[model samples]
Target: MGRIALAELSKYLLDGHLSRRGCLGARRVVTRPVAAGWMLPRAGPVRAFHAAPGSTTTATASQGPAVPLRKQLKDKAKQAKKQGKKKSKADSQTVDGWELTVGIEIHAQLNTSRKLFSSATTSFNEEPNSHVALFDVAMPGSQPLLQQETLLPAIRAALSLNCDIQRVSRFDRKHYFWWDQPSGYQITQYYEPFAKNGHITLYARDGISPEDGESVTVGIKQVQLEQDTAKTLVQTGNTHWLDFNRVGVPLIEIITDPDIHHPRTAAVFVRKMQLLLNTVDTCVSGMETGGLRADVNVSVRKTDDPVRKLGTRTEIKNLSTIKAVEDAIIAERGRQIRELETGGVIVGETRGWTLGSKETRRLRGKEGEVDYRYMPDPDIAPLVIGDDLVKHLQNSLAVLPDAELDRLISEFGLTPKDALSLITLDNGARVQYFYRVLDSIHEQVQAEFAASTPPDLKSYSTLVGNWIIHELGRVTTYKAGPLASGELSFTADGECAQVSGSDLSQLLYHLYRKHITGKVAKELLLAAYLDELEGGVLEAIETNDLWFKEISPEEYSVLADKAMAGEEKVLQEFADYIKFPQGKLMYLVGKMMRLGPTERIDPAAAENVMRARVEGIRAP
Candidate 1:
């Protein structure tokens, strides 16, 4: 496939499905799936800012256009702003001002390797029905045997959320008839839940919150253990194809109090919840992978009403992404507001979010507690949470986000936003990798730089954090398929093998000391991450010739002018800075970055020189 074609494929592959024809018209693709190094072609050497058609100029060659930096890593700042605007317009919808009260129920698949009620393997990649146990298939004689492996992560998750664990909690059956669920009902904590009374502080996020960083505390109603239904992989008019691999998968349903008042804030709250659950190793938190899903309860009330009676709340079901969560609320809010104003009553119903149409369509009237017909499970005994186990899990829990944020900001001198961004990167893997690199820099700087302490140690930390967030961030997270974790290598065993903390420290140390330009440092990161730098960055730079060549300001000016001479559109955009943003100049910069055989010139420095040259030309 072509580079641009493959890049488009890269985008599709991230969504858990790839529908393209086989590579090179061979009608066969390499198994293991094509992934990693999304920006450059799979086999070619990359130039700095390898501009593709339809990509905006000033953005990274991989991802087109620059999005505003967001403190909450999951939520994109620009997207949130635009979505918030839509929400404001939709919610501005009443004769009297209204308030949106939202409560979210999230079902996250547990991290256990096996199913909750049986020893059937829980891997989603397996063949349909291959991993199913007799119990999962609801064989007449088969009985449910609770997996003990399921409880540890659940306990850890509850404790991490600061919930009070119920010593004796029993499971009840939530009766429902569905093709995917082999059993007539799901075993869940209904009459008595295992954890309750916890609260999560949605830290004042820039784009997602009301006030700048003023924290809102949302009460945790309960955290209950449950079994997930099987997946409906394909559906025809009268037939449904099911994947039983997900059958009996362990899940935790976290019910939050109706404290969220805004759509964006609700999304932020869910984002925070995903982090907490993943932090305690409760579940694989990616919604795309069937790791988690959310159902939101939305009700609108008049702001001026002294009694403040909430309208009939409609449930929006099966929201798969954080963005969808926010959007569903916004859509439903608009629907309800429009209906109420038009003299139609707000009826309680279960609605499904349609992604294509971007609207909430009614599935059925809401199923009440009586409708579920909850009954205590006869097979599974009461869930007894021993104090000893709870205490042990409390002690063993990994540092939660709030405490970590405090440490990173106070001790490390990192800005709160930067610290949160660092920790939240790629499910906190980047933070671990970042800490290792930062700590290594602390020790290695003295020997490498020949100074006890650098003049501006704080700048070094900030620089390191930025690289991890920006460049390394782009390499690891730009693509959607097969997430690149802490280490940036394809080595077998896949630990911190090819590009460890020491390697990054060494590369950043060189870049920090002005031994190499930013372009050189980035190229080295790509090389090291892709395992092209076999003997580590130091050895490669020492033994191998430096791939990047530094050019002077005047040379950069000449290249910038050469790039701009023939491109009238870009030049015109440059001439009119107000009309064109950081967009058109990207092509000019990309041309300059690719001036040499390899990506050698520093983009930051080159861009500055190019801008100066553009100014000089326009200055009449």
Candidate 2:
């Protein structure tokens, strides 16, 4: 088959099955039947269909404009219609007989205070070996003591995935050798996961349908509670040192069935799962920090039969990011397709994701489940979670992104996309802070706007979300640990050192009442948080004049007009600034107000006046 034709088929398959379906926050339902008599293609160097053996696989010069897979599908569809009309031409030009099936296995790190079977802290960013406990280091005579904090969060996460949490669950040992894994065998929950049979909602440009999102309940083989390994730093001298801090951190291994059908779909599912996990404070999808990883299992076939016609599956391990995960799947798919097209076969093996080249390279070996030597831990008693306990957890379940999105839609009139964007956070605390700020703004703004119009949280939510994602993300990376030497800090026991909630609230209010845009407020917030966190401030942050100062109303308006006049093109660029005058003008007004007291401008009043002008811009 021509490469164009194969690309076209891939699209038809993706769109046909994933475009129109029905589902909303449900578990994966297995409905497709597996086909029999599938054959694995032989593996070898990939070559183009028309190329002779030993010919180079590199792209030739003078190819036309690159066509998108979707467009290729349309062209093929048109060609098919024309060919159907000419029986004589169809025999030579028509292409047929090919199928591809995909399945994905994702490993999501669980959020917890300590490791699964040890007291080693699971917190991110500490001294190299500080968090390591005796059991984590595999020290002699050390026995495992499972932490409820870890187990409970794992259970919640499984539930969040829409998986059926098994009523009875147990652990097993997974044997693997790597620098980070101090234990020869990782004790993991395998036989019974906390949950299974769940699904997540996904979105695509064409708008994924129920069937598209109705992902097959990729039978979760299990969701095991496990221990994470430590980090290894390789130096120039070929020397490696271990940072055992993360060695015993709690981890949940979620193993999925071979039910996924495409790479992008898998990416979407992983993202959805990440959002849910982060929302419930169950896990942090820390790609850079190795808190989240994926081992993708990919296979291909030439038959449309759901279960039949699969080439060998290759496992791509420890893909740290969503992009890497997606790219690996696509690359693997392309490889499989090309191999089969040239009468080559895919060999089952393990592969490593290479970000630099966006490809997967063969790993040494494949370790099947049988290699793990599943056995119950004799030291630790079986984990027994009571119904009442689960009920209590459900009752006290943290606000999830889904519920927050619903609130944004119903209460603030935010679009689903906007709501989802607002809730984006690597840590649950940040998301909670976002909602808190929104609630604060809503309480004040709603009462003021309620008599005339309904409240819209879009402005406040967007402002805060932007600040958190950008500014906070930057400041959090600073080396000095939030504040200076010491202002206030939280003890591992959960007690505050010097900072109090009232003081923090006052500092925030001072900044807010200054008429500061969220960006400016965020700068002040980071400074204040650091000061307070490091025991440097009690009343000092509140007394900072910069936090209370604002530009006067008239001065702000004059500056806004000047900015507008200086850039007429901006008027066209941000036409919405005039259309939604009140909401949009504030962003620009805030920019102008940033001149601070030198301009003696009150940004809040400047916003009102500038909004009045912009609102008039659209008037007859």
User: Which numbered prediction scores highest in TM-score against the true structure?
Assistant: 1
Backbone clash pairs for candidate 1 read 57-586, 204-213
Q: All predictions: root-mean-square deviation over Cα?
A: 16.0, 17.7
Candidate 2: segments with Cα more than 4 A from true spot: 1-100, 122-134, 176-183, 205-221, 304-309, 426-620
Mark the regions of model 1 whose C-alpha exceeds 4 Å error after superposition: 1-96, 211-213, 235-237, 447-457, 473-498, 529-536, 539-620
lDDT of 1 by residue, 1-620 (tens): 44646665554444323444455334433322122233222221222223444443222234333222222233556668989899666543322477788999989888998899999988857778789899997999999988998999988888877799999999999999988778889989988999999988877642455532477788989999999888886666777788888889899999999988888888888787788787778876578676889999999877777696878999999898888888888888888888887889998899999775667999998999999999999988887878898888888888998888888777777887888887776677777877777777876676655754455567678888888777775666543235456445322212255466777888998787667767668778877776677788878787866544677667777787777777887676656666545666677888887774354577777778777766764634
| Candidate 1 whole-model C-alpha lDDT, 0 to 1 | 0.75
- Clash tally for model 1: 2
Model 2 global lDDT (CA atoms, 0 to 1): 0.60
